[model samples]
Target: MSLFSRRKLSEYEPNDHQYQLNKLNFKVTKLEDRIDNLENDWECASQGESFQLANGIDAKEAANRVEKAAQKALPNELKKAFDEINSAVKNEQQSIRLWQYKLGIVNGEPQWVRIYHIAALSRELKKYGYETKLDSNDSDGRFSSLKVSWEGKETSDISKIDPAKKYILPLEDTECEITDSVTGKAISHEVAYACPRDDKWEIIYERKIYSDAVVVPGKNIISAPNWVKSIEPIEAD
Candidate 1:
């Protein structure tokens, strides 16, 4: 017989059983509502948590400071390197270029590397004061290596930081567009590298989920533009 049939209802002489079924259904409905509320809360929290880092500052704020720092005369070999590279690009005909050169280790030692994403480098340097040490269209005019820091309050000390290090540009994490692994949807991820080894210029970018950031294992860094944002330096273990 059907559970809802009159015969089944009559089977419960005290009517207690039928009443309990109704109570159970009501409880199930309440539980479902609670589950839905929890799901919504989780979604919002997940979205917020993604942009946050182990560092206390907002990723956006750190990125802005980085970008602004790009405009300032950088410290260490940054300003000198930035100036030399920036100057050379202006004389080139292409919008994008990569420069390769060798330079000293404070006492005439040498290193070999190339600076890619030339146009992007030029753009960031434009935000700062323009000065290039490149005296000729040839490589000889370019310092090839950094010697001293630029003259200004904006200088960063190379004593603590290496001038060859890669850094993120002053870009918001939201500027990084990526396809979600789970949803297959495009979304913004926090990003912080801009220029190169010089400043917004170098590549030590903001921390994000491994999936959200691109990494190059075994390579020295230089800054570029949006197209080059995928390169995050991976530290050796």
Candidate 2:
């Protein structure tokens, strides 16, 4: 009986090993099928036929289209930025010319007048039967100076004058009578020279003179000359 039981147990051990081998083979077959399906899905995505991105766009085609569009637009974007920078440089060059001196006749004598103040001097010259026009016949085809003509004859007599006297318009009284807030009395106060600023007259400099015995030098004051009130604002352009 002991010999029969031993032989039966040995037979059952071989059957259990065979069962485990069959189970491992089934698992390997299922793994191969999953790998084949993954390869098919990757091929479809690469061809842009079945696969889509989260935004419902074809992944492969969308990437190619976006890259091509960026390449095509890069030149135009660079050209626009270059044009804007060139325009700014030209504007700055024109502004620098405003501070330069130009030959013009002030009171029938040649003087080096500031380019920005040419319009103001021209207006003042009109009162004395003198006509003025901006001349662009220099090396550059832009207005660099004023051409003054009186009685139909242009003046070309260039001479040097006092630097302080150049570009000086006729002075007008800037005194105004205002009631003092502290004393409640009508007191006279002299303001500064009127300069053009934003289409209005702004006081730029002041003389120390007041009838109220008050020293207010840097006060904000806006006053225009009588001639400035009747004409348009001065501009270099």
Model 2: per-residue lDDT, tens digit, 67-148?
A: 5554333333222322333354455521111222557899999976533334444444454344567554555433465444
* Local error of candidate 1 at residue 168 (angstroms): 13
**lDDT (0 to 1) per candidate:** 0.42, 0.43
Q: Could you tell me every candidate's TM-score relative to the true structure?
A: 0.24, 0.22
After superposing candidate 1, which stretches have Cα over 4 Å from the reference?
1-98, 101-113, 132-174, 182-184, 193-204, 207-237
TM-score for candidate 1, residues paired by index: 0.24
Backbone collisions counted per model = 26, 0
Residue 194 in candidate 1, Cα distance off native in Å: 9.8
Q: Write the per-residue lDDT of candidate 1 for residues 1-237, one digit (tens) a residue.
A: 775897777877668876898899999999999999778778879788443336669768888776654433223223344445445446542222224244536456566433322223444344343322321255543433222213342322222323444333233222344578999897755444433343344433444553323332122232233223222233322
Looking at candidate 2, the ten consecutive residues that score lowest on lDDT are 213-222
Estimate the overall C-alpha local distance difference test score of candidate 1. 0.42
Task: Please report, as a residue range, the 10-residue window in candidate 1 with the lowest summed lDDT.
Answer: 153-162
Q: Give the poorly placed runs of model 2, Cα more than 4 Å off.
A: 52-237
Best by lDDT: 2
Q: How much is the lDDT of residue 67 in candidate 2?
A: 54
